[model samples]
Target: MRIGTMLGDVLRSLFSRTATRQYPVERAQPPTQLRGKLYYDPEQCTGCSLCVEDCPAYAIELITIDKTKKQFALRYHVDRCTFCGQCVESCRFKCIQLASNEWELASLDKAAFTNLYQRAENDASNVEKVAATDVETPDKE
Candidate 1:
């Protein structure tokens, strides 16, 4: 490495533009077919465990809330998810899908990433009981 060549290289490097993008100022757009966060639509879903069975990372779990009504609660853990889109593909009702144009999924706590969609049977009953009690409260004269 000659001194003259080293000096020339250093000068060229100093004048070159930065390759990194200013993420906060100008966020990069995700590709059209990018696999982002997993979204579960309980209204559209029929409690079929196909999505759970197909998930390679075991990130999805379906809990039956109402046995008579066939109501289910979907538990999705983003930390365990690989964004492979297998669960999305396996869903027959099209209730499972990767959210579009959403790539930023950072979280300080792992517990924040676990998304529980749909109310449990016990939860619904508890809420209703609380409301009933509130409504039936006697007035203090």
Candidate 2:
């Protein structure tokens, strides 16, 4: 509160380093296992809905085409995701994964965060159907 003490404090403030960073010039590297954007490899997925079933936040939804192949039509709506990595961990096939990509999430509408992923071939479902049938055996009494 004294005038002389205030003047001394003001002098020290001018020489101190800034708390803010120079951002663009000094980019920050994300840590290992940093949860950023979610990425799905269509070829790796089986449309089993295991990731959807394990998601704690219910952020994942599985949409499939009802052909003989039972192909996955879409995998969308990740905006409500909490980045808990539960879906990633639950994927037995290593189909679900998160990309290191970050910083494009901002948008005026909430819909902007929703990402869409679609599968090309339907071989996964066919494999499932074959596996299901292979487990059965005729009973001989």
Candidate 3:
């Protein structure tokens, strides 16, 4: 009886549709309201740290350049982000948005997920300053 049942199941399986997604060839469609990656527009940012404060995962790292001027550089750690949309909701300046369409962020290395988002106006000068500070350590050689 067991052999008969096994044989019947195997025959049914041969005609059944595949139950797995073809990820590489065909992408899965995320829900319309899915909160995916966080999009930060630096020009709209007030550097109020509301998003930083509200994030449950502690994913947002904000470097305040000038509190009076509201200049901020946001370092988004995607690996630690929970996609809870709390940061987006708490942002009063409307600078942070969760791009629901940007969900294909898979990577092998954790470092690749650390994305730097800032306005075009502040990027150049901040990049230079960060680079200068990074290279300041003396070589052991």
Find the candidate with the highest TM-score and give its number.
Answer: 3
Displacement of residue 12 (Cα, Å) in model 1 is: 2.4
Query: Which digits, one per residue and each the tens of the lDDT, describe model 1 over residues 1-141?
Result: 999999999999899997788978978777889998888877777766888777777787776655477566677889888999998888889988898687689989877798776643347554344434432221224
Shift of residue 117 alpha carbon in model 2, Å: 0.2
Model 3 segments beyond 4 Å from truth? 124-141
Q: Measured by TM-score, how close is model 2 to the native structure? A: 0.67
- List clash counts for every candidate, in order: 0, 0, 0
User: How many angstroms is residue 56 displaced in model 1 relative to the true structure, after the best TM-score fit?
Assistant: 1.3
> Model 2 segments beyond 4 Å from truth?
1-9, 22-26, 66-70, 120-141
lDDT of each: 0.74, 0.64, 0.76
TM-score of 3: 0.78
**Model 2, range 1-141, lDDT digits (tens) per residue?**
999999998988889987776986876787767887787776656777777777766676665545346445334455777888887898887877776657356678876666656555555565345434442221323
**What's each prediction's TM-score?**
0.75, 0.67, 0.78
Any residue pairs clashing in model 1, and if so which? none
Q: Give candidates' CA RMSD values in order.
A: 11.1, 9.5, 6.6
- Top candidate on lDDT is 3
* Candidate order (TM-score): 3, 1, 2
